[model samples]
Target chain A: MFNAIVSADTLRATLDSVSVLVDECKIHLTDEGIEIRAVDPANVGMVDLRLDATAFESYETDGGIIGVNLSRLEEFAGMADAGQLIQLELDEETRKLHVQIDGLEGTLALIDPDSIRQEPDLPDLDLPARVVLEGKDIDRAVTAADMVSDHIALGVETDEEAFYVDAEGDTDDVHFELGRDDLIDLVAGDAHSLFSLDYLKDMNKAIPKDAEIEMELGEEFPVKMHFDIAEGDGTVTYMLAPRIQSD
Target chain B: MFNAIVSADTLRATLDSVSVLVDECKIHLTDEGIEIRAVDPANVGMVDLRLDATAFESYETDGGIIGVNLSRLEEFAGMADAGQLIQLELDEETRKLHVQIDGLEGTLALIDPDSIRQEPDLPDLDLPARVVLEGKDIDRAVTAADMVSDHIALGVETDEEAFYVDAEGDTDDVHFELGRDDLIDLVAGDAHSLFSLDYLKDMNKAIPKDAEIEMELGEEFPVKMHFDIAEGDGTVTYMLAPRIQSD
Candidate 1:
């Protein structure tokens, strides 16, 4: 019998806002670690998440399990009445988590635990460049790209003294420039990279636009984004592998 | 040559929130009168919309003109820098509306005017059962239904009774009940009706949960939802043709 208590709104808000990309549907569960991985549809994008176990009120498991269909759970959490404490009960046989709120009356079925795949080996990369930015800036950059194309080219040049994203399509072309004042911090070399627009959008959904995001970029490498979801709550980190461009 | 200025965030928020169900891309512009017709995918939903000439800083057009892809403009508005004034320029030949925000420094290609469909005619009906509900509560109901099924059965018995939405699926059966306290106000009806989930979700997206929503329901009839959008700065009303269940 495993029981856990968490602010349904908090968890729901995070998942609904994020989880837009990768469909792997794995959330690492440990005494001290928790992670979630889900893929967005081809046009939709991908997300890589790493959260500390401390964020949970009470996290206890004899071992650990991965749950499928996080998007379903996110939807359920979104349905929860506000200010209501969400109670999660894991049923062994049915292999479903029964979700209930304190005052409201209803039971929500979580996707079966066994249905989600476990990726034991997600490559660890040494990202060379790191930058801290406001959530609003990232959201703006994503939106700017929407006007141009589905794929974005990102570059960091110390000589240019700015971080930029460029997208060009038949209908429109867009360029986003972030200066030193707008960026909290930037660490870069003369390196550049590009990735699928679908993944960036999914990853941005996990956090609010106002929250601060820490980003790591490398030449032709997957980008890492760390979302400080709520001050003093916990962190959600996403690392998305870059899509190679064919010239 | 036609040009107008408006707050990007406000216009974007208003349009994005209300156009959730409207498919007729052509928004009629005639002597400050605006009209459009679209069907809600769900029978149990409604969106009430009205933007009088007085709301516009400038009202210049006397003939009806089509406006396509207002939704795409709204998406741009979402990312528009706060307090930025949005400049709109219309070109008759290209049927494109050029959108520019000062600080953002970009141009957006709006939907062609000719491609937009004309507004549909929605006759006025006598909706006896009407009530005001907190936007948040309605948002919750939509979310709850998202978890259980794609269809929702909305019934209003009386103020003394609770507002109910019931959904049954193979995996789970769920019911959401909101009492008078949970409701801002409630009105009763002789019978209830069911609607598609997709429509309800779309309608929900058009209005904020904190905003007041007036719902009218009848036996096997389309649901009428009136939205006091932008704090009465404008109005958006939706009448969804009902889908009669086989059973």
Candidate 2:
């Protein structure tokens, strides 16, 4: 008996998003190393996906398995009826996953799981400041930046009791603010950073509304976001290097 | 001051959808002839948009005004804050519409208004049997057809007491049935028609869940779907020629 649990929509949306950045997906199945990676076709972008194994209600495997063409699985999963159970069965020889719901059936052909590029070696960043904010607030901030700029600087200062997202280009600068009350909680004196708007937008697509996202920030350090999709269901995390701002 | 009222998401979703079919758009303003012509780049697909003066909430024009490049307007409209007011101010020389929301301002460059394509001359046919059904039900039927086939055959007969949508391909055939109880009303002696699933899917995108849609059918006549959108804020009706099924 095998039991694995995750939101169908969340997984579908995440893959749809990450597929936009890379062509091949490499996923590690370590109880602790649940991460997926792919290098952008243009070689300009890379996706580093990390999720906590504790989030899975049940995980039991006598042997490891790998597969290819995750985008096909994502497409089939996207069509899943909301709230419907997504049952996955792995065919050992074909290396295909038969995904069945109550009324729909689809067999997603697997790709060479080994072909996925290795995850980049990111240093364990000690982000000093962390903040818990509403998912919708960050969504709106990203959308505002999408209007006028390609990059954004996110700044959170606990002492100032404010969170600011600023995007400035040759033409105009767009800014979104959330004050003290807007923050569910804030632990300051450590993290503040800037990142590419493109990466943040892609990562934010999978974040469901009402999900409390915990963000870790550090000057010139990579930004990390932890997503709690549902209680005891699964936790998805993301880390992206900050884009250096040239004055 | 010029004011036009439309359903926010409805108009946005519709334009976003139809834009996939055509490129340049030309709208004509005349006392006797009021229509919008959007032609596909290949000249194969055309959307002939027509609305009578009576459909307008308020019509004020000293001389007819024409506009082109609907795609630009659609893009700006998409970015307008949801549920916010959209105002258009025409700059005659540059042929640009200064689009303004309550607090936002932007410009949509217009194409050559004189290059509007001529509307297709479709003759009015006598369709004997018509049925009124729920929008959501038909949408579901079309979606199911989309799963199995590229075309669908619609059969409506009062004697049969039910409407049927059937699609068949190499793998499987799918049929969706809506009974008399499911229909708002039915007026039929004998009627049957078939149309390309592709066009039907495009048409269904304009329909809202709760709207009442009237379908007119006949053996060889083009199928017609009449419904109001934006809570009757505007009217969008379509007539599609039937596809002759091959033996």
TM-scores of the models, in the given order? 0.53, 0.51
Expressed as tens digits, the lDDT of each residue in B125-165 for candidate 1 is 77656667877767777777666778778776664566677
DockQ of 2: 0.04
The clash tally of candidate 1 reads: 34
List per-prediction Cα lDDT, in the order shown.
0.65, 0.65
Q: After superposition, how far is residue B76 of candidate 1 from its true place, in Å?
A: 33
Give candidate 2's total backbone clashes.
Answer: 5
Q: Model 1 - which docking category?
A: acceptable
The alpha-carbon lDDT assigned to residue A103 of candidate 2 equals 80
Write the residue-wise lDDT of candidate 2 on B173-228 in tens digits. 99988778889988764676777888778677766768898887888567777776
Tell me the lDDT of model 1 at A184.
Answer: 93
Q: Tell me how far candidate 1 lies from the true structure as C-alpha RMSD in angstroms.
A: 12.0
Which stretches of candidate 2 lie above 4 Å from their native place?
A1-247, B1-7, B13-21, B29-72, B114-117
Listing every candidate in turn, what is its Cα RMSD in Å to the true structure after a full C-alpha superposition? 12.0, 10.5
